[model samples]
Target: MKQPLIIIIRSINFSRVNKERNKRDIERNKRSKMVSSASSSEAKIISQCFVKPKTVSETSKDPYNLSPMDHVMLSFQYIQKGLLFLKPSDGAIKPQDFMETLLQKLKDSLATALVHFYLLSGRLSTSVTDDASSYSVFVDCNNSSGAGFIHAKSDLSVGDIVGSKYVPLVVQSFFDHHNEVKAKVTELVDGVFVGLSMNHSIGDGVSFWHFFNSLSEIFSSQETIDNNIKLFCLKNPPILRQVSTGSVYSLPFSESPKSNPQFQTQVLQERMLHFSSEAVRSLKSKANQESGTTTMISSLQSLTAFIWRSITRARKLQSDQETTCRFVADSRPRMVPPLPMNYFGVYISLVKTTAKVGNLLENEFGWAASKLHHVVVEHTGEKICSEMKRRFNPPCALPSETFYDPTIVHMGNSPRYDNYGCQFGMGKAVAVRSGNNDKYDGKVSAYPGREGGGSIDLEVCLLPEFMEALESDQEFMSPVSPSSG
Candidate 1:
């Protein structure tokens, strides 16, 4: 297997804006005694969610087996530089306070919760990771560089690269920045950009949203901060029992996308959009009442249907085969007493939905959206256990084999993304962006803004032809469905 190219630039030098940071250190030491030690706490969290694999065959499935280069799979990298919003008189900011608060937030965060158990064993044959321990979760802080800034990176696996990569994180940050904090911070060459590398086998864009939001919750709150915090409680982690056997599908990697002779290296686009959270919520409410669909399914369905219709219209192509959209489902409740929140591992499943292309181009957007909603709900059922087992089983010698399909489209969104309160002593973030491999050519993602009241920030990545068509339609550019508000 080929390894990914990774570049990491780190610097650590920080100056406090408030009173003597040493005074806060003393206070932190006092708090440390009150909190549990790192070794014991991390160990407890690990045990709460993971059990040692029963056999060697299971070990090979660990995503870690793919090598460290694989760690770079679905990565979205960004560099933020600027002065952040900091009111010295507002209150005293403490480092221990930030760490402790973040620790607690990780405990309840859906991302931490799902990762704890799923990453323990090995790679799951389907969704993301099958093993939890094989995964790595670590963050590097930079305070020494003369320029004050932060860098962030999010990784994806072979499956998600084909779909658009930049869409998820950009959308996530947009929603987070506009809806939750509403604080205009900073976006410069010296700002901060956080990075996370995980396999799509573990979770999808939605799962990423939940995890990021949990982190933001911790960063913004000074009251709930505590040094010694617990991240996961084992009240049925991994939710494996809830998974069914019928919906699983085999994805043979025999056939992959051929590199185009005309295309060279892929470069990503970076931009920031502002929206109010209030607008997003209102749209959700309307969609639920009128179409009887969950916010996740309804919004995504509309976006996918619109993109497909526009593309087909441009190509002058027509077909009866249903267009498909696939994403992921985090599975972390199958264990008794659940897993720890910060257990960094993979544990997620895939959910695929298909709708007829003709039905999607209908005049009534709601009607087309509802059809997509139904398709998503019907295909992602929890009755595919046998199917999952068969798909992941070790390969066998055969004259003929099935191949992976490149045409299958996958879409997802994380309303929680825009919520990461990335505030250092300086200010807030000015902008955030993301991108990925060719697999995500037509992928679309959504996220909330820290200040946007109800409207979510959206990102769409498509082939040049498809993108041109979408841009050609003014409605698609501002196409927030009535249900989405």
Candidate 2:
């Protein structure tokens, strides 16, 4: 007989009475552990990421005024260094030099006219000035106390990962309700942190990458960096002006009364997992065979099934209830004639799947997983896409009083960044950590790498019981394949 795989799911929703008690118990334990851990070792805590711009010469201003699209392009100049360690011997690669190099590379490699527009858009406001200001570059770094390194903050360590709080103006609405959300990023003793925020209103991940590629090239060489990356001044540059009356770009919350915010602010919870490229492939294969779907679809299905099961177990939900999971997809590819790969604009669509509480806890795991795959497929069809397009472009809204509550959110990291060598003379880091958005019940980001044959670095957040169950499960904690390192 084959050994069955085990997964732990801790549910977040509990009867109101039990929720507070559970949260208290978790918090108490966390505080105790933190005290004990801090007393035992030298560690540091750090703030979220923040970026400082290079002061430009006012006299050298280009003839063309900056557009919002230019600001979106400029925002893409930020990069995430997965794992970077200091090499004290490399005298030339100081932090400032690395940043300047990166800026120059972007100017040389990508000359799209929109870069000018993005830069212009960003200049209008330091924070939440315009729609193009929604793009954000989140810099994640580790906190260390070894040797010459100083302490970061109260909650971080030599290898702990933390990032900028949110995606620029995209989360401005959250700040409007709570001032803490707008707090400035502070200095850290042990870790390097910085984030560039742009308007997600202007671009998606693909466009961000395009702008990053240009920046990377310039960062790699000063002399080779080109001045022509500024495209807005050129004739016939693409335009992404806001549609004044289009129903698609309107916010559903616009007409609704503001409700009290429920979550905390700027606080980040970090977690990391390493899966060998080969092991990820094997699991993907197994998952594909089990669900008969594409890699992403299968992975999403299995993971969702696993999460729902684990959460239900922790919640001890009685049979016959229901729950939901939501995933975001970039829709730039589906637009008419397809949007530019480097078009700096916000264009995303969502796919949601809901299952009965009982269906998740059914006897067979594979069966439950298959059902999830089917549901996701059904939810991502033409009608759904068309409806989403219509909603974003012109005019539509969910009914009043209806809230889009998501228990889990998932995103895939762009794999291309790996080739850029995020290290600036520092040895490559052993692990990279991306923090979470507290706005959701839980979040997961998937990153791809070449070594160990291609695996993903997963950042996850869950209730204590759910986290405990997930880490304790052999199927999840164990190496998927013998070669997985």
Candidate 3:
């Protein structure tokens, strides 16, 4: 494959924030441990209840069908997204009243949004086939069941969160999901955090954000919602029609998104690494210049290679050891006839590239990047459909080894996910984070930088030693300071 270089680079020099940050981070890291270790006792759940749609559709009484893609997704856990927001600036409102209003508005708005996307209110269910050979899973739409909504609070302050070098493990408490979708709003001093956990079978990234955007719009819009269920976002209502894949299944009969994931045991650390636009441009320019292929090299492609290389180097593996880099692409546009952008389901294609540790570390940056570029471009419509069908037809999950391997690195989520715009009348979010349900060593999530433009934020999770090595690697640390984001 041929490509250019430089999209997002790795490493950060916190020198800009404080010349003494190295010493300060050490102290802060110790304090952070104390806070996370004890804060579980401080997280309080005030109330929990299912929020049904304010209105119901006649067809909603029927079971929501699952596509081949949704079936394969059943092997995975729930998709979790959490956003951090600055509390509305108006101080005139009493704290008690503010908390009361925020919770009520969000709950009410969520109910309203559920009316349009009623399938999400259903629970996962299973049924035996007539042949008695296998079973199928689907959404059992129930009028009484809807998205789970929770009201929570914590003693930890906003400063205990975004201000630190690593994300606090305490944030995971804000979300928990099974077969059903759920949302939680935790009131903290000076800021508010909202978390949403959804069944991966229910939808993909587009569907997930559509529901989020709907809730935010309803909450912020002054249009008073009546029992009639005022309609919003008329242009792009969700399309839940099942897409056939000509694939057979011997899937797990259980009907729910697994809250817990199985993985190797290790002391892990998570940090958000930011690559500013200038640094990204420089990396890309340098990478493309070296490869002599500017036209094919994309910022994202280049950035992925940069992250893969940096993390591989941190592992300090043998020269002949193999490393794998995997990422997913939306198959909506890759289908032969092309699925609608709003078509709701897990229409995705996975792209994997492998290389010898010696080759990747020895070659110029663009060589590793082109491997990713070539693999992704080769994933045509036919191949995507084939992969989706063959992925889970035999009723299996990716071996535990795929996630636990020290030489393996995987990236998920997308920078284009409009996460910062997922507001509930609280203005734009200042920072965004994910829950720990699916996290493991080498698990990485990508988000658009708060500063926007072409910058990127990589939420990385690794073993303590691996993370320490990554932070100390000057080769990857030379380009930028993550604090600017």
TM-score for every candidate vs. truth?
Answer: 0.47, 0.57, 0.86
Choose the strongest candidate by lDDT. 3
lDDT of 1 by residue, 173-224 (tens): 2111111111111121222233222233233443333333433443444345
lDDT of 2 by residue, 330-366 (tens): 5555565566545545555565666676765664455
Model 3 agreement with the true structure over 374-404: per-residue lDDT tens digits: 8888889999767665765554545334445
Model 1 lDDT, full chain set: 0.34
lDDT of each: 0.34, 0.36, 0.70
lDDT of predicted model 3: 0.70
**Which candidate number has the best TM-score?**
3
Ranking by TM-score: 3, 2, 1
Q: Which regions of candidate 3 are displaced past 4 Å?
A: 1-42, 130-132, 177-180, 224-229, 233-235, 243-264, 394-404
